[model samples]
Target: MAKIVKPLSDQQLLRYSRHIMLPNMDIDGQEKLWNSKVLIIGVGGLGCAVAQYLACSGIGKLTLVDDDKVDKTNLQRQVLHTENNVGLNKCDSAKQSLQQLNSEITIDTHTIRLTGEVLLQTIQEHDVVVDCSDNLTTRNELNLLCFKTKTPLVSGAAIRMEGQVATFTMDKDQPCYQCISSMFGEQELTCSESGILSPVVGVIGSLQATETIKLLVQIGEVLSSRLLMFDAVTMSFNEFKLNQNLTCSVCSK
Candidate 1:
């Protein structure tokens, strides 16, 4: 456990007074959040909500990576960017919004597309990684890198009024994203094809934020080896057990 060097300033304490009141999230947990770092890949619908929550929660540092620019179509679900930011790089827009939400957080924006090398380096820098990208290829790549670096990954996806969230790590000997991908098979639909409800992303993204906080504070059981499925229309959630694949090329190999 890390110790606080100095008492929080009155204003700082006042700002986080509510968080300080949580039983498990006392001054120490708040300090842990302030000292921890996280990286979010893809600033799309889910990423928008995840960034807003994490940034406002007083995370010390946040690295946002995205290659695309804000577009009119993105306004439907991507809440972080607005009409005025339509042409701006998504990462840049996210940085600006995150800074305004919590100036205390150090926000780093990368406008370039994420390759394996960049993803590996960014994961190494942060204590936790959140996958909000829409594609499976990126998610699989991220999972491999996370496993290789021993970093914990929070993965979330939302489509057509439903969503899912899971945490993957090699640390607990739990099934990784690679295992899930292999079990489910690679065929998946993008939000573009199936369409996603606005609040569906919000629900899953908030869960991602929750898991990220837990990982940062090293408290509570992460969703390792469990697939949490959410249904917005029915407002119900179900979790299925996940199994590690001994033959998984990315994790087992």
Candidate 2:
């Protein structure tokens, strides 16, 4: 069943006036965003940036998932949390921030880690999923779930002045995360261990947000089938074509 979004009200028209003025994203695109639902998995640097942009953009329903609590260490890049929220759950803190950004939008918070049946149910509830998780395990799980459910996924990662963003729509001819993960073995390095530049995650997260909006509005060329890699040291971006592995387990059918 398709969601029937109400026409923008006078306040909404003024609120999104700049967006409506755009050639690509006029009233129709803004309405599409108003009716769209997005599930964001993670509340760290990437998640914070992604959530902030999407919230301000007027996404109809934004669900934030994270099991961690805010820490003093996160203040540097986790823009959604302040020193006052240092002890609160990341999802709760993020919800507060997002609500403050746009009171009209609905913000849902899940403070538990996603897995098994819960993960599947959550993914099915949203039109799109954004993977801002840190670990390979969570990323792999999200990839499989999105593929199985046929939900579009916008994935982003940042660490040590390097960042990458990709979109997977579960198209049989397109490459999924599992296909890309298979190329890079099991080694995983986290920001705490490697040390990350603050703005790197911001750049990647912003890109993820852009891709998400583009996907929802059906405007512009999406990042699907391409992996965008950013190097802060050189301030350059490289694009790589992703190939689907026909023999791989996930999305091979």
Candidate 3:
């Protein structure tokens, strides 16, 4: 966590001039993000948006985890992969594109499905973890590992015309993802199962990126302890406060 943050290069100043101009994100904040490492799980729609923006925003190192490959069907929503890279692994495809987006940053790819052994150490290595995976099991597992490590987690999901974004600070006083999942119960919504609009994931993913930047740079009000829901059909956005469950299996004990 005490990694040295070097001074911005002339090209960095030129590339991220807009971010450097912002109040809290001056050279110091930009340098912080430029030196930070972020672990992103999944390379689907939500992952595409989150990774792309963070790349463009100049997050120093982005480690992407996904066992899946690029599918022809994913072309509609997964913006990072190209038709030419259809048969390629998603993490490999994302690394290629994201590196092109920002040559100054480093992009790492892991082409394996995460397990308990891999997830725990990975969460401990990164400053923040973004849960963009599609399954309930993975989300639940990532939440628990993140809580154990006390690393911040930003989660997003989009199916059909609706999406939601939430952040877990991994603070004892704040709610863990398990608390929310307990209330809502598990109901996996895969794009293949129910279908999804192209831009719906974009909206949600961009918000996730926004929250991540705030967390990384230590600026702006983040979505911590709050849930943000979006309805593309009605174009309405709603916010809900989240409370810790004292009986939560992961966080309570």
Best by TM-score: 2
Per-model tally of clashing residue pairs: 0, 0, 0
Give lDDT per model, in order. 0.88, 0.93, 0.92
Candidate 1: residue 252 Cα off by (Å) = 2.2
Model 1 scores what on Cα lDDT? 0.88
For model 2, which pairs clash? none
Q: Give each prediction's root-mean-square deviation over alpha carbons.
A: 2.1, 0.9, 1.2
lDDT leader = 2
lDDT by residue (tens digit), candidate 1, 200-236 = 8888999999999998887888898899999988999
Candidate 1: worst-modelled 10 consecutive residues by lDDT: 1-10
- Which pairs clash inside model 3? none
Angstrom error of the Cα, residue 66, model 3: value is 0.4
TM-scores for every predicted model: 0.94, 0.98, 0.97
Q: Compared with the true structure, what per-residue lDDT tens digits does model 3 show for residues 148-200?
A: 88999999999999999999999868898998888765666689999999999
Model 3 — TM-score against the truth? 0.97
Off by more than 4 A, model 3: none
